[model samples]
Target: MTLEISRLLELTTWRVFDVADDGRVLAGCDESGSVQLVELAEGGCTELTALAGAVVGRYLPGERAVVVQHDSDGDERGQLSLLRLDDRRSRPAPLSELEPLVRDSEHVHRLLDVLPGRIVYATNRRNGVDFDVVIRSVTTGEEHVVHDGGGMVAEVAISPDSRFAAITVPATKPLSDQVLVADTMPETGADQLRELTDRDLAARHLHPGWQPGGLVVTTDAGRDRTGVARLDPRTGGHHWLVTSDEHDLSGRLSPNGRTLLVLTAVDGAHRAALHEAATGEHVVDIALPSGGWCGYPLPEPVWSPDSRFAALSFSSPSTPGDVLLVDTATGTCTPLTSSAAQLAEETLVEPTVHRVPARDGEQIPCFRYAPAAPDGSAVLLIHGGPESQSVRSFHPLVQAMVSRGHTVLVPNVRGSTGYGKRWYSADDARNRLESVQDLADLHRWLPSVGLDPSRAALWGGSYGGYMVLAGLAFQPELWAAGVDVVGISSLVTFLENTAPYRRAHREREYGSLIADADFLREASPLNRASAIAAPLFVLHGANDPRVPLTEAEQIVEAVRANGVAYEFHVYPDEGHGLAKRANRLDAYPKALAFLSRHLG
Candidate 1:
């Protein structure tokens, strides 16, 4: 039985964003067309904010209110607000009634942490470029600029005593960052800040969480894989708590300060374990659903007040996004949310992990999902981030295409994470075209996995979208068709037209406009658009802030001038990617139809 594309598109998914002391869960669900805030407490679900795109939130100290971070119709200009628990309605509320704590259509205000009497956040309201960590009083509404980061502050962690603020900022190298510790309330003339990690070394220091004595951090400094370490705020000394020889590890201390949840990245899947924070003793290995991953931004498990139970957002190839409650003592995993929308589990396909050898002898990690019935054609789905990976998680588009009898291949080419720092940085700057070559390598090696190279189509979003256009332009003879969603066509134009604050950050990975303009132009697919003869389908958001709408128009225009077969559409109420289900329903089915005509 074939699952209709509309049915897969309409299926609801939820993630446990936060867990309260009283056992209340704040989750984001797509049950109402778009992702909205909902409260799960005492055996019932309460509707909170029905906002646009996706919303991020955390419960206030007493669990009486929540600090919500939401953006306008995919614009990505996030605003912060405080909504009282008593004020929430059983029905959806209009945007106008949700009064703002800090609202600006131009500047982004991200919610970091909600403490007892204050809220900590990072905002670019001052210069609209550099983000500053701010501590605002919940009762008095007074603001304190704790760290005036000269550059972008990636993460922030307030000390248990509210004395220090640990933040990470982008380092000089690509895919690397440095941690900085600042005094939350400095005295009249004291030195307020110090760099915890060596500024001389280019490494990734992430997920700074405060414990009793110091900050628990995940870093790959002076090492190949990320590992857990404890950073002393006063002396700036790192004590390695746990180091893995094979895989990357990220540790987060529970609220009770007794246990630490450690997630190890084994290939693309996650292996979770709990450890004693004081002695660093291994407690129990959490047995998550086979092939299930605690999905990205790579959130820490939301622990209960007693630190005995943890709520994790788990998903596998067959499962939709859902929450799982784990018992730390016995490692018992229980389902907390039903996000599959009652779809039969057997109807979905699970991908088998593979390592396709590249021309340079490097093995490229990939996931292959074969259809139940043969269609003789294949679709190669590229992940964006160029720095991100296609992990073992529920992917609606992949499932729908597989249901249509198309063999799907998701490759983590060079520059993809979950492998390590070396692999992720393999395609940085001057080596940009090398990662593109990995696509060609995959094309040649497709036959070993029983896929026909000539009948394959390309599909991707963002950087992956760039891969679609690049694959069509550079390796035009290999693909049958292409589907690009908010991808970059020209690297030069992308750097020039992208959001101001994002330009410098992206330049670190894709090469800069000042020094490497010629290379950026050469590496761009739009320059070789004339070589592209394959049928193409393009979709973009009119208000996308990351890649911008111009990137899509440029490729679409170039292909049109060449008289290449193509289809293009823009959703006015989206950004970066399609967040609303209605747009996905309207766009994806057409993309599938286009592939069917060209590849089938």
Candidate 2:
């Protein structure tokens, strides 16, 4: 049953970045890790552009061009390029050529919308610190700032008539707590910036976009669960578009602005539905055949220009990801690409969703993958972004371990999103240690599903990596081995050393180092590394900007001083995660070996 590493690496990974306005052409990353333009009718794929490292942004209005973001060595501070499909013989040009909106040092650039004669975008090029909304003419190359503010412009949307721009200004508070609807007049330079929504220090209002009458956003303003709501920019009136008690709802307006494509996440699973934009009447519920994660870049559901079909990216435990077309009328789905066809003969395990209760009576939703044969050993995989969820995605490492007879349990811990806002922010600041307790509760519940808690390993990246370190430091007896990947070890140092642009945002979630100094030290696993009883493996990218290399080095220093068995690795060319296939191939096997040596 030993599978070749090459076979696993060869699996075609696909990610749908954008569907053309006409929905005839789909743009996405292909097997070679390059963006390709696929024509739906003929099923012909043409290589659009290839770079050392690039992520396809979105297609322009008429599908004549696309925005590609490229970075070197995963630094994240990369340049944006416009890949013109019309110029088939020419290569992508740097976005600066069109207008000097993004400089070499100013790496954050986002395309907001494409108007009649201009393209609207958001960039930190104004001060290289805070984002500013800019409108650049397509023909003249003249640009004007629509909204310049002291805070980071998180989201931006240009109205269809190109008169107003709705921007989410997160500077009002630590988190994005306000929305500014402004008139984009070239003569005034956005002098009239009006507040569209009332500020709530506790609630997060995000994804501001324009509809026919007003602005629409995802907010938990008056409820625990985040839902889609329409806000009147003029009168500050609010109307609920979609609301749910058991699930969180967020969506996007169709190209014609007649329908709303609602994305719902219930217990870590995603479902899509089309609704009447004005009446909130559900039209058709699109069935997702792939039981996996969806909507990575917020509202990824793209409607066709005619609003007859919607295209989206989907991935499951067995499938990597593919662009799917869903008919609005009948809700029939058709796959536009087959990225996981290479694994057709391989046996993949389907994850079963289970709710395990924590000591405090909170239900932790976990995805369990059981092997065909019993090994009496298991691994608990934690997800990053304590705000993110662990959905049923195609995880090669999980499959590899399961293939060798190991059960894998991935939990959507309390702090994870896709749940209500209250549950998502449950682990803020001092309350984060409670999340570690949730991990212990998960270990205690393992035996109920025929798993041996004593023989279990803990594995995670980013925040999950922090959880791995926490599990070893706090609940030492629960895990046999642990793997930490690009995780925060010292909260205080991490807050001080992380990228400046991200400091305030991280402070909003993890608690500020200046204010919560004592709590940060108390929760940091590095300070309590002496309590670790299990063998540890630490993996990180040297270029990581979020957690930084020091986070891993400091913990390795502690483990070495404690005389604990441990392995440490740092990929020189990677950033947050092992994004490059070669790095993954090199790093994952070492992780599998470490788990095997300790847990088996």
Off by over 4 Å in 1: 297-300, 304-308
Q: Kindly report which residue stretches of model 2 are placed more than 4 angstroms away from their true locations once superposed.
A: 2-6, 33-43, 86-103, 171-177, 186-191, 290-293, 297-299, 305-308
- The residue-by-residue lDDT of candidate 1 on 293-362, one tens digit each, is 6456335578765576688888777778887777777888777676655785437888888899999899
Best by lDDT: 1
Error of 2 at 3 (Å): 4.3
Task: State each model's CA lDDT, in order.
Answer: 0.84, 0.76
What is the lDDT, from 0 to 100, of the residue 144 in candidate 1? 96
Superposed Cα deviation of residue 216, candidate 2 (Å): 1.9
Which whole-number lDDT from 0 to 100 does residue 556 have in model 2? 91
Judged by lDDT against the true structure, how good is candidate 2?
0.76
Candidate 2 residue-wise lDDT, 95-114, digit = tens: 33332333465466677666
Measured by TM-score, the strongest candidate is 1
